[model samples]
Target: MANVYLKEAIRTMETSSGTAANYEYASTSCQGWRNTQEDVHLILPNFDSDTSLFAVFDGHNGIEVAAYVAKYLPEYIRQNRKYKRGRVSEGLKEAFCLLDGQLLLVDAVNELRAIRRQAHPELPEYKPGITSGCTAVVCLLKKDTFYCASIGDTRCVLCRNGKAFPLSIDNKPDDANECARIMKAGGEVVHGRINKLINVSRAFGDHMFKMVPNMSTIEQMIIPLPDVIIEPYIESTDSFMVLMCDGIWNSMDNSEVIDFVGSRIQKKMPLAKITEEVIKNVLPKEMPPSGIKGKDNMTICVIKFKGKRGGVGSTNMSAMPRTTVRGNNGPNKHH
Candidate 1:
């Protein structure tokens, strides 16, 4: 079985929110019915003088990979040469791969051991290998634009004038481009899963799938490349943006989610409350639709731009489903 549930669900919610230059945000996560909480996120409202960063990570096998990424990705992005050279797009793309490369078990031994010793000196530090991985959805508010980079199905959506405009696309194994890459790497998409082991075509870590002879990093069965989407931050129409994991998307589509969050904001509900209600609204009381993955770990990040209209009141941007390539889903997940 790919999923596990606790005897009883954990209803407690972890929430965070803050304000930056022209941006304000709130994020929340729930352990739900899962045996353990594997989702993680980061909220840096004042990342720098002119920019801010927000992201969500959906851990697959465990939380180690997601937690590590949540802790290190910002520093990695900040240090990338391309980003330093003013090529933000290239910088983000390279940063994802660079970070993933550091996860190679053979090379991470010293690093992981050192980190583990410091975090939990009494706990065991030995592990066979790095088998865990996570889906990443990152959003960087740079000046007057939004840069969203993502791998796997985690997503970032912008609510502009009450409309849903997805910033990052879902990278499922069933997707054409994703499927093609998997096949070319001698991997198969079994029941929409990569080699019947994972559902996402791209992710951070998951080193088990990266093994193959004579293949470049991008040619691996599971790559770390991220799709970066750029959208201008228009104050008049763009209200707010939503960055969420599959847990949230599993139950709500772009329209329903945008409208759901918007209606709450219109009622003047707090951002943290809006996020908590979203998880509560979709949390199942019994076996989830498919028996495979029942209730999931839920996470959401909302970024607001104080504007003339303010997302349905926060993020109403311009882009249709096709134009933005929001994406497709399959069983073991949602469609």
Candidate 2:
């Protein structure tokens, strides 16, 4: 039997905004039974201009990559000139790409080595060929608008009118476009794994899969390009948003998670407690057939929008506009 390594402790963080929208947010991370916690999250309520930014980074092979992204991605977004000019979509895209490039720098590797030495002196020094990466799902809310950027399998779902609307697409080898891109870059997808090793087709800091020559960053085998989605927040219909890693998705479908969260919100439960409950419901007590139970680190973030009257669905319903931004692909406009 595989020894069960349980990090049953759960960590929670929360903040509230005094802005006109009265947005409140809560987040939690549970190491689960994994030997190491490889998940990291960010919560920046009232980031700027009454905006909030929340994200979850799920790391594989090591936690350094996820921790690095959580520390620097937000700074990159804030520093992007496009973001200051109100071109948030472009800003996010640029930020994702810029961070990926920074990861390949020699200084970045030295920093990682320093961090590892400080944290674990016994571990061998970080090397150039080291393999590590992370999946990122970020949600940015400004006024009545919501923007999301995702890479890899981490997901974001918006709960609207008691229904779950996926705000991000999962990047996997099974995806036709992703698979084609990989094959064109001299990479192969075998058993749903990219190059028979990495499960995600897109991610940040996987230098090993990104060694293809003469290929643009976006055309690399496992690129850092994120699919960006933008939506107008409908005060009346839209309830809340949830960001989580694949650990939560592996056990529950989108609708199941929505229903569970909706029931908890209806009971007036705290957002942090709601996440804790969701983790409890999904994490298995023992190793399952898939061997995924308790082996993956779980992280969740919840953002609650408080309307003028009070809770969600308290206002009138009206048609809202939506827009989605794709890399290389043309813009998808909706009403």
**In terms of TM-score, which candidate is strongest?**
2
lDDT of candidate 1 at residue 124, scale 0 to 100: 51
Task: Name the lDDT value of residue 218 in candidate 2.
Answer: 83
Task: Give the runs in model 2 whose Cα sits over 4 Å from its true position.
Answer: 1-21, 117-130, 309-318, 330-335
Candidate 2 residue pairs in backbone clash: 5-33
Model 2: per-residue Cα lDDT over 189-245, one tens digit each: 999998788889888888888878777788878888788898877777778888989
Alpha-carbon runs more than 4 Å astray in model 1: 1-3, 105-107, 110-129, 287-294, 308-335
> What total of clashing residue pairs does each candidate reach?
17, 1
* Candidate 1 least-lDDT 10 residues: 326-335
